[model samples]
Target: MQYISAERYGNSYRNAEKKRYRDRSRAELVETVAETVFTFCAFCSVLAVASITLYMVVNGTPAVFRVGLKDILFSSTWKPVAKEPSFGIFYVVLSSIAGTAMAVILGVPVALLTAVFLAEVAPKKLAATVGAAVELLAGIPSVIYGMIGMMVLNPVMYRLEQRIFARTPGHQFTGGANLLSAALVLAVMIMPTVISISETAIRAVPAHLRASSYALGASRVQTIFRVVLPAAKPGIATAVVLGVGRALGEAMAVSLVSGGSVNVPLPFRSVRFLTTALVSEMGYAGGLHRQVLFTVGLVLFVFIMLINLSLNRILKERERQDD
Candidate 1:
């Protein structure tokens, strides 16, 4: 090889090494920056949740203390504007629970069947069309649902009530604005969510499981009911919980159809839910009334938390049994 200048050779080697080192440093810096950004995003989410929880607790607890927890939770009468105001929300709470239960009862079976059809029975093209319809249903605004219920379902309910209670003595029909109407609206609103989630879960079941079930001479229906459904129980349970949350927290739609009266949660009677109670009077309310609305929010929060915990526990127990 031709002899090279030592200085030149040394400089070239140093430059090459420097180039490699700079490249490595740049890559490491990019990675660090990316990691930091991801961490910040996660932190922001946690911060948001923590802040909301803290704010609700700080603002809501004082009213609960002032109002007396027992009276606020257990007593039936709610007269906030009266000279001697009583802040009882027992009927509100009951209506919320009852309406949600009724919605679930009416919605879940139909949703399950729809999901099963989409996942297993229906032709692919038909399933795709129906899936699109379901997504469209979900995209429809809650306010629109309320408006439609008010205009369409309300009249139908009024006619039905007229036929049923016309001969019954002393039964007043408030033009079909009642707990049943609210529950029906809630059922329709929650159907899309339940069906979509359950269908996804059902389709996610491993193909091998169904094949094995068939190899064991099980019928198609049997395979689905015993193997696929059981395997997908966690996801289905999650869908149900989501539906419950929606039903519980729904205000505008339920408020429109629920007649806005604080009453025991009879299907035919005008009633108010916890969410409606909060929304109905928050605008004009003052002082303790405002604070008590926060308390209602707090109580609703607790109910959601309890529902989540109970459902999670059930899912965990199911997982253990399956294992």
Candidate 2:
């Protein structure tokens, strides 16, 4: 082969280098744009949370001071529009806690068992059908749940209420919409979330773990309960935390069935939860009345934040112990 001239060789080398440079530049530009977009999305999420937190704090704190912190928090009176408007929310807070707890109690076991069935026992076709149904349930609007609760569950609750309290002396009737009815509705509302997430978590447990358990002479049920469940504990806990959050935060569905009364959270008693407090009275609320509603929002926000933090900490500790 003939040797190339220096100028020609130089020109060829430069063109190759230019082509590589252009390609690299294009790739870098794409990467930079992608990074920027992702960063912007993340920033927007953070900003949204910060804005809500700030707004709640700003709107909520002044009302507490105006109403007196102890009176607002500890007192049970909630006659917002009465002549001597006492603005206590103790009972509302209690009702929310009781309702959420009751919902969790009724919902979590069914959700966990259903999740286990879907993950470990169900055939593929059956699992798919059930999974689709669960997703559909999740997708159903809160208002629809409320409507169903009002139409179907309320009458059942009313009949049960009459039967249970008819013999009790001086027992007051709660019609149909009451704490128990609301809790039942909340349990149903929260189930899909718990089931979907728990199923996902259980399915994520490695096949090798199941195989190893079987090799050690463990039955399928034993392996699922002892090995797979332990491995999937974190995810299950996360699901439960999310479910609890959903129950606590629900406004529309709870408001529909909860009777919107500021009473003690007895099962047969008509009552309002913290979420319903805001939902029921935000309209026509003026001045300190409106501010008090915002205060309720802040308290709810704090409750959620505390619960999430506590659950997260427990999860971390559990993980560490397991490790």
Candidate 3:
């Protein structure tokens, strides 16, 4: 009887040990799997950023060196087909600048007003509705915006320009598709971004600041311009930068509205922006022409980088000031 009992006990102990070992093995496998997944996710993110940046740098640098920075930017002629293609990228740059400037001029006020209305004036329900609309606009595809410009806004602008010039004789309307038209369209496209960012910035300013301004017998307008905007300068600057970046890189809408002529900027003349140049010609271009287009893209990338860097520095300084 004693021998049988001992054998049974030993069998039971062996089985328990086996079960414990299996559970530990499963736990280790789960941990390993979790770690591997996390590592993979991290690697994917790094690879994505690195690949895009690397591609831009590699493709763009050669164009920059080939063009000789000064001549490429300042040269008047951009004939890219000769024994030696004299690639001047300035015409597009001018168009981009003009369009961006017009966008800022038109967009800033409307954005500021919309932001103020949402942040300070509107009731919660009204604000929610308006904010939703702004977000919807932002989510709309660029192609759709371009289509709208081509179909609706372009005609309207054309008529308006004719009327304005007719009434004011010798005030040349230039053409329907010029800097003014492109800028206006760009302004419309970037409005949502500006409004959304500016509103958030304004709303973030301490409520107490406005109340204090009121206590000091300040008008609403005064409080807004003086207290709110100044205090929210950093955030507003960020919003402007964001808007500028969008305007600078905009291709489809600008392409549709801008006359796509490769000429030095004339106030009333239709012209091509760098982005539009790429979109319009990339389909047909090959060899050196293709490289030139890529180089234009590189120039655009550099502009965006500069804006981002400047914004970051300004924000950092603002944070330091606050500290």
Candidate 4:
């Protein structure tokens, strides 16, 4: 070979080894830092959730236990204005349940259908547009929804009383701000929640599953119902739980539309929900009245926790079935 310069050869060889070593060192540092960051973030998030829940429980438990379960839940009279007022949370429970039930009945079908259309049938451009619109709906503030219900929806319901009464026929009740109206308002308020969660669940079903179903001569609708929805059932259940939680906790929207009455409702009669009750009267409450509000908050917490626990159980069962 031609004579090579000694210094150049030595410099090139050293540079090559140095470059390789530098790369290896840098990769190791990156991996170590990434692992540390991930663990810290995960642990911090868990701690935050636990801390908040514990704080709520600490503040709420004293009132709940002292009030006794039955008196808190069954006694409908919520007069805190009297001396030595007792806390009763049953009406709140009823209101939460009624509102959540109405939301589920109205929202589930619309959300499921919208999800199906997006995931299965819509053209790409149309699907994108619709999905964006759904997300936007979900992102709109609850306060704005409350304002709209007060200004627009309340008047609308007042006008539609005759139509609603006509549909019921036997009921001669004549009031716009009532249980029915509150339920209707709650239904609208929770629609975006169901739609967003359901859309996510539907989209999570594997494309391969749908393709396999179609290859066996199933139509699109058949494939969707039999293959996609069933596979995503657990996620769908979770979505329902989440929507119910939103409906139950909704204060401003329900308060604005709901008649601010603490009495247990007749089917067409106006009534206050637990959330609305707290919000409506908190401004004027003192002493035991304040404690009663806390009790309402506690009851809502329990309701939401139960829903979440049920959803977790559902998901676990689904997982077991999958395995």
- Which numbered prediction scores highest in TM-score against the true structure? 1
Q: What tens digits encode model 2's per-residue C-alpha lDDT throughout 37-111? A: 999999999999999999999999999888899999999999988989999999999999999999999999999
Ranking by lDDT: 2, 1, 3, 4
**TM-score, cand. 3:** 0.85
TM-score of 2: 0.88
Report backbone clashes per prediction.
0, 0, 0, 0
Better by lDDT, candidate 4 or 2: 2
Please report, as a residue range, the 10-residue window in candidate 3 with the lowest summed lDDT: 167-176
Each prediction's TM-score against the native?
0.91, 0.88, 0.85, 0.79
Residue 318 CA error for candidate 1 (Å)? 6.0
Could you tell me the C-alpha RMSD of candidate 4 in Å?
Answer: 5.6
Please, what are the lDDT tens digits per residue for candidate 1 over residues 1-323? 22355356787777777798999999999999999999999999999989988988998999888999999999999999999999999999999999999999999989988999999999999999999999999999898888999899888899999999989999977799999999999999999999999999899899999999999999999999999998888889988988898889899999888898899998888998999988889989999999999999999988887888877886787678668
Error of 3 at 99 (Å): 1.2
TM-score of 1: 0.91
- The candidate 1 region of ten consecutive residues with least summed lDDT is 1-10
Q: Write down the lDDT of every candidate, Cα atoms only.
A: 0.91, 0.91, 0.84, 0.77
Model 2 global lDDT (CA atoms, 0 to 1): 0.91
Clash pairs of candidate 2? none
